[model samples]
Target: MTFQAETPKDDSARQVGSILAVDCGSVFSRAILVERVEGTYRLVACGEALTQAATGEEVLAGVRRAIQRVAEVTGRALLSERGFPIVPERADGSGVDALVATLSAPPPLRVWLVGLVEEQSLASGMRACQAPYATVCDVLSLVDPAVLDDVGGLTARLQRLRPDVVFLVGGTEEGAEGPIRRGVEALSLAALALSEEARPVLLYGGNSRLRQTVEEIAGPAYRVLAVENVRPSAERERLVPAQNALEGLYLEKASHWDPSLDLLRSWSEHPLQTTARALGHTVRYLGLQAGMDVLAVDLGACTTTVAAQRGQAFTLRSLPGLGMGAWGSGGPKPSPERLALWLPEAIAPEEVLEVAATLGAHPCTMGQVGRELLVEQALARECIARALERAGLRPGLPWDLVVGCGGFLGHLPRPSQAALILLDALQPVGVTVLAVDATFLGPALGAVASVEPLAAAQVLEQDAFLKLGTAVCLEGRGREGDLALRVRVRYENGDTLGVEVRAGTLEVIPLALGERAELELRPGRGFNLGPAHRGRTTRVYADGGVLGVVVDARGRPLSLPAEPGARRQKVQEWHWALGA
Candidate 1:
């Protein structure tokens, strides 16, 4: 099969026919077809299938079947129907205007990690690789004297895996040369062992000492490219170069092994590196075009990725240790001690463990018990906060927007339920606005952005984003009923409105997109919202979006006297006040 790449020009009015996007995630594969109608592309058909039952030839068969099913159900033939043109027949004759497939396969991209110290520089290197779509295949810790002493054994181990690529990361800007030279020495020895054809590509994001050494050593055996060090300083981390390198390696090397690659090769555009790339694209695009920092989290079965964009810099972290899926069988599982730090005392350890294990195993089951649901929310909040911290973004960073993506948050049966899940998961503080990826199309638009940025931006503005207006909450924790949040709106058109809400409440105010409304917040007696955060009146421009207003009641311990029914009553009161 041959791969075709398309460079669609910047013509907003271009009459591109129905185009289908197939995202092969770890748990399931999905197809979405969009048709350009009246100069706007609209989603017309979609389908999904469990991904585990297929691989290799079986994977191709599944795609064929899914595309046909969606076509049949949508009353549009795979090749032809009414105003749409026939998706040009390939030499093999299956139909589609343009088909794009992305994969989030397990045994996720195996990478040979090279770094300075196992604990510090190497640790940061692992974090950098984990940020994109990669798995640490083997870490060659240069600081480990054993690695330097046993070059032959280390070389053998690396050759055995035939890793897709070697990620060479090391050095602090102050003392980079030593570790970088040592890491390159290990890479050179490893390169000598592999056959020319089997020799893995090397991406160096390390110190300057070994630039020429690495290039010369890898020249005859493999492809070597140099980039900026991911951990250039102890205080900051630079991960984009590593992430880009991983995506480059996936397209050039890893795709060849995927069973679905042949089908993807048949499409007219270059294959994408799954939803991760798309999410990265969206974060970057939104950050650049809208002039605001953005954070997007896609919680999937086998892994969860947290991506953030600030200015022109973007960071992505893949938490392989924590996920809503079963593949984390051997890794460190979330413990009671960790859960206890966030959960209320009433939720038993056994119940917390059971819920965590259930989510770890099932990945998709909604919690059946009320208390269990609360525990899950607490876990999600903890996970999100930890991810943000890793990226150097605090929960209260004056972050202009926070968005939730993936099936669990976007496709929930009810909008309120979706909003509540986001509220519980993010536990966002300060005056941040919120939204969810309504179309699950962030990745696709991101890929398109690499080629046609304006088109991608336009599509995102018109179709992908759903605004969930400003969230009003105190910066710190609060007792169960101590702080109340009330919003008063005075429209420019002289309309006056008021709504009283309590902490822990997620209230939805009726507002429409692009429609502007002025908001004023009245914090309870002991609380503040502005300069020292000292101001009494704060005006905000509210845009109708996904999770309207999140009042985090658990700003503090959410304490209630240990009387049996008191805790339940407090929870009920908070829920009632939030209109749950």
Candidate 2:
């Protein structure tokens, strides 16, 4: 079959219509076909297969198979007899205009952090440095127990971590420069002690005024980069400079580290990007386009990534060892008690730990056993929570939506389960919409968004995302079991439903697909739905999904009973109430 697509009228807005994207993930390699049909970009076809790269060089085999499936299904002659993609579509339509790729295959990118204080600049630095591809080996703050302000101690720690990059961030712009200068000296001394072959690269993201002072400390032996201060002030964080530098370095190093990517580079029309980085750019683009704050997370087999954009600010944290696959050298091993906490009944902590340890080495299959599902959700909850806490976003800021990505979330047996995972982990308060990446096409779309902005926006407007309805969650506290919230939803068919949710519980109301609805939320006295609308009725337009309007009265802290039986019963009740 022969196909035709459109090009935007504006030169800058115009993008290649026929594009192919291969996302080489830790567990699976997915290939997708996007073409501008009529006037908008559409996701026409998709295919997936196991990566097997963790075991050997079989990732190439998986990529070929996935692309082949798409080509066969669409009757397209995209690949030659030898299985390589055809470059630039011929007049007969045997190839695509562009081919791009995103990869999450490497172990976490090793990083070391050195800031002025453990809680302020150090914390802000952590927020700036977190990404799915990054692993913060250690944080060396002036107050850290590990740093005694001695050159030997700093050098020893740096040597032990053997980081690929060291970030020196501290001191608000034009604020106390003494502590940051000390950090610069320590990093410089450490760089000198290590052999030239082993010395890590360094970047300074603090105190623009002291740029020359910091440079003098590095001397001629080391290269020091100065970027925007991560914590420009207590009221804000500017991370774009540091984030770009980190990814630029990672991309530079990745070309030499993996030979397989070279094959992809030669076969494709554009450079490859890290999945998380591309996703970050897309998140920023969407937030800006919609003029609202957005939060997204990608829970991978090997890593977990959380990205949020509020206006012009962006925070992305990628935590290693929180996933179902390998996290690289010296990665974290989950505490057994963490996983056991979510089980319905009492189980051996070792059983949970064993499952976690095994999953890190090998991902569990789709048809998981009961215990395995429990472990998976438990780990998922904990991982998402940890990533969020590290972000340290302001409490009063409103989040317009929360999105769940990755295999487990995308392939959830029930839409309600995915909704619950997001609700439980994020606890997004009041007037927030929830959605998934549909079929785990986030990485592919993210890569596509970079070169084809209009195409990306078109695909997003079409069906690139699956709306899972909206959530009105309470944020303030009241006595447990007290009257918490009253929700009323009116559907387009003139049908109406009202529900009362007690404090510290969850309630879900189904809104049929293709149905349009609006909601009125009234919170009880001393209970607030969000920071702005406390004890006031809030109105919002509802988005429908398999599971509709979720009224969560689980309170701000969202506690469970300390007793196992009681907690188990509570868990069952919550799950049953939502039909998850």
Candidate 3:
């Protein structure tokens, strides 16, 4: 297997007919095979198995098992006698042309944040920490209550934490440097207290003027790296610089995360990539290719990532310990009452708590097909909502495409249930196209693009993405049961269906998969589709999937009844409407 750091300018230099990509997640490991069929890249087979890294075994055991399953399905010999992948296919076609991987199973990096102001640079630093798989163990800022102590006190605290990275950020470029310089001194002192081998790496992303002062204070004992200021000015924030630096650190530190990782690295021909960063790459690439604003939400067992791209601007926020796998973990479990708000069935709050506890204890178990499934979906909604809020994305932006990835969203019993979960959580305004990562290969493709851009692009366009259909979500408000939108659906086959959608209700129009239709939407006096289409008639040509065009006239910032009984009824009605 081989990997490249970036796509080469010349695409014709390397030729690969077959590719193998694997993702070693916390709870599950997956493998996929993509091959050229009729001169086009296509997904040939997929296999999944329980991750074996937690059992004191090398991750390769699980990856090999997944590959063995695929080989069984396609009658392809991918692994040799000793479990190592065969490189460069022979005459008999027993090997692949290339191999690549993405990993999310290793322990995240421990980061300590130091900045001048709590609400300014420190807050910006907090968001940047989400770029990599990292946890903020502590923070020291001018406004922090703990900052009242002397340098000695701060040194002792830092000694106890012993974080992997000390991220120092503050002040604007060419702005006040005194406060940030003081911050650097205090943290450098704390870092020097540790032994040479135990000392943490210091990264300064504060005012550029203090770069020399930071190096002088830390001396040679500490490894100091400087990057573009995270806060170039009070009103502007640039996270890519710090995010890139921390991501590099994550790659360096991850090699030691497990005894088997070193072996995995040795077998690889290229550098390992983080799952979150690779997923963000695919999101940005697809958005640019489609020439539209795009948003992607990946719900994993141990993490939930939200990435968005609008024109040339892109943002990614990865929140650890906020996924379905941590639903009832020790950190912060939502109250049953809060979760019950989204449950469609009349389930008691105590029952909800019990199920969440059991699921959290055994996050890898995946046979939920009853009330338990409903509870899990409810938990997914909350997790996605929290990740989006923390992502700091501008609300009410018309997302031309919204893609959902991960097991829970991908393996749902019905497509409408998947669509409904996204709708309830995102509540996106205006018209948007919804799709799912059909083969869980979005990140893998991102890794493969470095070596084979044609294969990655072809598979992504043909077989990797499954469109769940388009959504027409209303943004304005009107009295309940009042007319909100007059919709006319004109199918390509010359069939027409007209419906009057009322406020506070959900409606679905049936259009088969691969079907095409043109919709004419006329909003009522008080309601419109979006900010740009207020009180206007809009026409859109949309494609179909499992669920046709969804007309959500429930208003923006969808409201719910305060009374539990009334809310349950409304929620149940929505489920029935979607046939979920």
Tell me the TM-score of each prediction against the true structure. 0.78, 0.84, 0.91
Off by over 4 Å in 2: 1-7, 10-15, 58-61, 113-128, 139-159, 166-197, 202-239, 326-330, 364-367, 394-398, 477-482
Error of 1 at 249 (Å): 2.2
RMSD of each: 5.8, 4.9, 3.4
lDDT of 2 by residue, 17-54 (tens): 68888887768888888887885688989888887645
* Model 3 spans > 4 angstroms off: 1-14, 142-152, 171-189, 195-197, 209-213, 219-221, 232-236, 394-396
Question: Could you say which candidate leads in lDDT?
Answer: 3
Clashes of 3: 0
Candidate 2: give the clashing pairs.
130-317, 130-318, 131-318, 132-318, 301-325
Model 2 root-mean-square deviation: 4.9
Provide the lDDT at 496 for model 3.
94
lDDT (10s digit) by residue, model 3, range 1-580: 1123243567676578888887778777888888989867888999988778466877667877888888899898999998888877778989898888878877677898988778889989987887768889998775454563476787787778878888989888877876666666666676666678788889888888888888898766479989988998989998888988888887677666766666556655767788887788788888788788889899888888888888898888877788878877764586788788898768878888777787678777655478888888888888888888888874456898998988878888888888998899999888899888757777878877765777778877778678888889998788989999999999998999999999999998887778999999999867788875665899988888788889899888788888888999999999999988
Local accuracy by lDDT, each model: 0.62, 0.75, 0.81
Query: Candidate 2: lDDT of 54?
Result: 51
Worst 10 residues of 1 by lDDT: 1-10
Q: Write the per-residue lDDT of candidate 1 for residues 1-580, one digit (tens) a residue.
A: 0111233465565444556766766666667666555755556666766655533444444555556667676765664433222455334533555655566654466788877767667877777776456777777667776777677886788768778778887777677476566556666776787677777778888765566777886676568988776777777777777777776676555356565555455554655655776677678767766778777887666667788887767777766554555323454466665555444346677877777777776665666447766666656655655656655666545456878777666655445544544555555555667777765677666655443444455566667666766666554444445656678876647787798755544455665555567788777765555233457657776665543444453442223435545655655554554454
